[model samples]
Target: MATIKDVARSAGVSTATVSAVLNDSAYVSPPLRARVLAAIRDLNYSPSLAAQNLKRGRSQLIALVVADLANPFFSRVVWAAEAAVAAWGYSLVVFNSDEKPEAEQRILSRVRMLSCDGVLLVPVGDSTKHLQRDPDEKPLPTVLFGRTVEDDKSDTITIDNISAGRQATEYLLDLGHTRVGSITGPLHLTTGRGRLDGMLAAMKSRGLAPEPRDVRSGEFREDAAYSVARSLLEQQDRPTALYVASGLMALGAMRAIADLGLRCPVDISIASTDTIPGIGGLRPRLTRTEHPLVDMTNEAVRLLVDRIRRGGEVEQRNIVFQPSLVVGDSCAPVGLR
Candidate 1:
């Protein structure tokens, strides 16, 4: 609880001399420096780093707001972001909105109150209005990660969702599956809508379309996907293949398929857009389009840091990374096995 003044008084020196020794900003005789160091140790005095950062108009903190922390996909994002932020000399503050816009609003408000230097956000809403703290003050430095919204100012780092969908569906089609279905995320988000659109487009290109009942929204949730996939597979004329929109949802679907006593690539084939931490170990490893999650997170942090340092003078940039198809035994050609 000792202040700099207390250290200076104990050291028998002016507070300025104490500060000089602490900051190493000015020359101090060895004797005076020794006294100051001794006083600091005896008094258990520690300077306030938050106060010092504030005086320089920085918090040395960056906020990373993800839509769903329970999802392993976002957990990977957090891991990558932590290292990327630290490499730039900033600590990371994490928040999970759980895919709720109200929670997103509150989290962004808290970020503003904490005066975070920048934000890397996985947007949960259709707009970025919450990022603007005050009409008079400038907008916070922000980079939207893995998603985009109705914001023109912030930079965006995203995967080609449409390509992800198209690639997965094309893989299924190439394997000779005629009746292909999909379990998708909420259609309101770009990740959901774009992937579904790509699936439909790929089907249309092959002169085919899914039945209205064949596609279901899984809300990007494991439990929801489990229920939906169970119901879809219970039908008498279910599709032979399913294109799951996300890795988490795919896990749920896989579990559902097992619960129903169905085997992958035999009774039904499954392909998905993203991959999670343990997905590689699944029997008949998932046939999916994999996003560069670590690279995307690093790029998002990089853009946010650039915006924080350069302010609005820098041009807004939207960077899109492509997904690569990783083939595995989860999918098999129809009538071949």
Candidate 2:
């Protein structure tokens, strides 16, 4: 319970000198600085973060809001973002919106109260209405990550989800999978809509139309995907190959296939849009389109920090990363079985 006053008294120096030494805000004589350090160690004194932030006129805290932390993809993003922000002498506060717009709004409001310097948001859907600031109020320095909102003024860092979906579907098509099915994320979000659009567009190029029953919404939830996948697999004319939009949903679909006594790439092949940590250890390694998550996280943090430093003077930036296809053992040619 040693305060700055106690340390100052122990060091025989004024409180201002102690503050200057602790914060590195002003140069002190070498002897005085040594005495202050010795006193701090002796007294076990710790500077108050609130007081330090107040004196500096900034909290040096960044908010990172994600749609779902339970998903490994987002968890990896959080890890990388935390490390990136730490390197810049800032701390990251993570929030999960559970893919709800209202929750996202509430979190943003809380960020304002916490005096956060900037935000890195993965929006729930295409709704940027919640992000609109009043004309008199300064906009929060934010970088949208992993998802995009229409007409948003904030910087954005995302992958080409449509191209990712198209590539996954095309790979399956190349393997001669004519009756391909899909478990898609919610259609309201750009990630979901763009991916589904890509898959359909790729199928159209081959002069094939997907049946309505062949596509189902997983809402980016594992349980929902499990149910949807189970139903799809039970159909009399099931698709020989299945394309899943998210890594979490893909895991669920794999579970459903296993529960039904079906083997991947033997009865039905599977490909997906995302590859997450530890996914390689699965029974049948998933063929997937991979996002550069660590790179994207670093870029997002860098953009947000720059915006925070430059305020309105910084120009908005939109960065889109390309997805890479990673071929695994889960997919095979249609007739191979």
Clashing pairs in 2: none
> Deviation in angstroms for 154 in model 1?
0.6
Output the number of the TM-score-best candidate: 2
Candidate 1 per-residue lDDT over residues 136-177, each given as its tens digit: 898889999888997557899999999999999999999999
lDDT tens per residue, model 2, 188-274: 888998899999999999998688899998688789999999999999889999999988889999999999999998999999998
Tell me the lDDT of model 1 at 209.
98
CA RMSD, predictions in order: 2.4, 1.9
| lDDT over C-alpha atoms for residue 117 of model 2 | 93
- Number of residue pairs clashing in candidate 2, backbone atoms closer than 3 angstroms, sequence gap of 3 or more or interchain: 0
